[model samples]
Target: MSCDAIGSRLTARDIGWGPNAAHTLIEKVSFSLDAGDRLAIVGPNGAGKTTLLRCLYRGLVPTTGSVYVDDEDIHALPARKVAQKIGVVLQEMPADFPFTVKDVVLMGRIPWRVGLAGWTDADRQQADHALEHLNLQHLSSRTFSTLSGGEKQRVLIARALAQQPQIIILDEPTNHLDIRHQLEIVDLLSSLKLTVIATLHDINLAADFATKAALMQDGRMSAFGPARTVFTEDRLSGTFGVKVRKRPEVTSGFTFSLAAS
Candidate 1:
C-alpha cells in the first residue's frame, strides 16, 4: 500500500508534567518532526522517555508548554479529532483480545464512526490495506489471542495504520521479542515511510532506522538532530553511564560495555 498524504508536522514546545512541586517527571522537552521524518527517542531507564511520549501523544496534558500538530494545539482539539490524526502503538498490549486479527485491526476505525452505525465498506477496505501493507493477510482470520508475540505486535501496528493518521507513535516497539523478531520489527518500522516517533531501548537500531533522534536525560532533552549526530559515543556513554563503542565492521555498529559497580 502507498503511504498516506496525512504526513503533517508535529512539534513540542518545552512541554512538562508533574504532580507536585517537588516531583517533575518530564520537563522542558521539545522537538519538531516534519513530514516523513522518523524520530527515535532513546534514553536510560527512568529518564522520563515514556512520560515525555505521553505528553507528545496527548496521553497526558502537560502542566507546562504544549504539543502541536502543524499549528493547532493537540490538547485543544477534541480527542476523536486528535485520534484521527495521531495513532499510537503502545509498548504493552493486552494479554488476550477476543477477536480475529482483521476485527482487531478494524477497531482502529472507532474514532471515525458515526453514531450507532455499522462498519462500512471503506472501513473494511482500510483494515485490509493495513493487513496487506504489514504482511498480516494470512493471519487475518486467526484468533488474536492465539498469535505469538511478534505476530501480536505486527497486528497492533496494522491496527494503528488502519487509523490513517498523519503520524504513528510507538513506545518501545521491540520490547519482548528475541533478536530476530526485534530486527524484523525494526525493519518494518523503517520501511513505513510515514511520520513515526518511537522510544527505543536499542540505540543502534534507532540510529540505523530513524532519520532524526532525540536523547532524553532526566526529563530533559539532551540533544535533537540527525540520528548519527545524536547517537555519538560521548552522548551515549554519558547519558547511559556505559562505555559506548563503535564497530564500523559490525552490522549494529555501536555497542556498550557495562559501567563498574
Candidate 2:
C-alpha cells in the first residue's frame, strides 16, 4: 500500500536532446523526485513527452545535461546495471518471433542472468509472481503474438514487474485498455512501491495517478510541481485547447469541454 523509499533519487538536470538546435525534441527540462513519487509527464502530442521520457530512462542519451540516480550519472552506468534499476513498458509492441506470454515475462530475468546460464528457479518464481500480480496466469501458455492489445499490455507490465526494478518507466501505459482495465491499471500503479514515470494522454487519469507532475509545452517544461498545482484549469485549457474544470466530488475529479472553432 505504500512505497519502499529505497533511498535513491532520480534527478533530471537541464536535460535536452535532438539531432541539432533546429530539431531539439526536449529542451533544458529539469526536475527531481524521490524513489516513491509517481511523476506523470503530460502534454499535447508533439510536446516531446516521449522524448523527455526516453532521456530519463537512458533509452536515448541527451545531447545536453544528464540524468542522475543517487549522484551517479545514469548514462555512465552499465547497461545491465541500468536494466537492473529501471524496467520499461513501452507502447503496444508487436511480437513476431512466436514466444509464449510466459516466455516474454521470463525475459525480464535476463538482467539477473550471468553470461550464458539459463533461467534459474528464482527467475521462474519471480515471473510467476509477476504473472499473478497482473492476473496474466491464464495467458501464460498462450502465444504472445495472438493475444489482444489489452492482454499484451498487461503481459508487458508483468515483464516489467518481473524485473523487480527500482524504477519503472512507461510510455502510454494504458493505450490499449478499456475503461475497467484502465482503472485497474491506474489502481495497480498507484499501489506500486517503486518510482513511476509515465506519459498519459488522459488528463484526469494523470491527475488521479500522479503525486507530482511535469507539464510539457513545445519541448519545454511549462510547469512542475504537485499534481493539483501543475494541472490547474488555465494550464490544462491553454495547453490542451479545451475548457477544463475540476470536480473534486467525482472520482477522476476533472471534466473537459472542447474549444470552439
Candidate 3:
C-alpha cells in the first residue's frame, strides 16, 4: 500500500516541552519523515523519546518550536484531521471498561465516523482483517480485560492498523511481548510499509525493522540516519552509557549484549 495517498510528511522544528517542575523534555529537536519510512526512536530511560513522540502525535504541544504535517502547521489542523493521519499505541494502557476485543479494535474507526459515526460493514470487515493480520482473529470475540498482556498489546496494534492511518506512532510497543510475539509485531510492521515512528527499547529490533534510526539523549536528537550508521557499538554504548555488543543471532538480524557501563 502506498502511503503517498495519506497525509504529508511529518516534521518537527526546534521542538521542546518543559516546566519548572519537570526539566526540559525536548530540546531544539528537528526531523522530518516521508511516507513509507519506518523510523525508530531509541534512547535510555529519561532520554525524552516519549516526549518527542508526544510532540509529533500532538499529545503534548511543544513548549517551544513547532510541528508540521507536510508544510502546514499541525497545531492549526483539526484534531480529527490529525487523527486521520496518525495512530498512536502507548507503552502502557489500562482499559478498565468492559469492552469486547472486537469492540476495542472497532474504536479505531471513530475518526472516520461522522454524524452517523458508527461501525459500518466495511469497518467491521476492516477490523476483522486487522485482527487476522495479527493472528488475533480467534480472540476477536473475547473480552479485552480477559486477555493476556501480550494479547492485549497485539490487539491494540490491530486496532491501530484498523484505523488505516498513514502514519503510526508506537511507544515501547514490545514492552510485554514474548520473543515470538515481539518478532511477529516488528515483522508485521516492516511488511506494512507505512510511515511509522516508533519509540523502541530494543536496539536490534529497531535496527532490523527501521529504515532509519533516531538516537535521543537528554532531550536532544543525537543522531538521525540509516540503521547502519546509528546502531554502531560506539553510538549505542555512548548514548546508553553502557556496553552494547552487536552479536550475530540466529533469529534476529542482530542482537545486543549488555556489558559493564
On TM-score, the leading prediction is: 1
lDDT values for all models: 0.90, 0.87, 0.83
The per-residue C-alpha lDDT of model 1 at residue 55 equals 88
RMSD of each candidate?
1.5, 2.3, 2.8
For candidate 2, the 10 contiguous residues with the lowest summed lDDT are 1-10
How far off is residue 131 in model 1, in Å? 0.4
Model 2 vs. true fold: TM: 0.93
lDDT-better candidate, 1 vs 2: 1
| Backbone Cα, N, C clashes tallied per candidate | 0, 0, 0
Model 3: per-residue Cα lDDT over 1-261, one tens digit each: 222235347788999998643678779899888877889999989999998889898999888989887787879899998887788899877766488889988988888887886679878887888888888889888989898878888888888888878788999988877888888888877877668889888887888899889999998999998888888888888898777766665433443556664
Model 3: lDDT of residue 22: 66
Preferred candidate (lDDT higher): 1 or 3 = 1
Rank list by lDDT: 1, 2, 3
lDDT for model 2:
0.87
Model 1 C-alpha lDDT per residue in residues 1-261, reported as the tens digit of each score: 333544779999989998877899989888889988999999989999999888888999899999999889999999999999888999988898999999999999998899999899989999999999889999999999999999999999999999988889999989999899899998998888678999999887898889999998998999999987888889999999999998889755797899888
Question: How many angstroms is residue 197 displaced in model 1 relative to the true structure, after the best TM-score fit?
Answer: 0.3
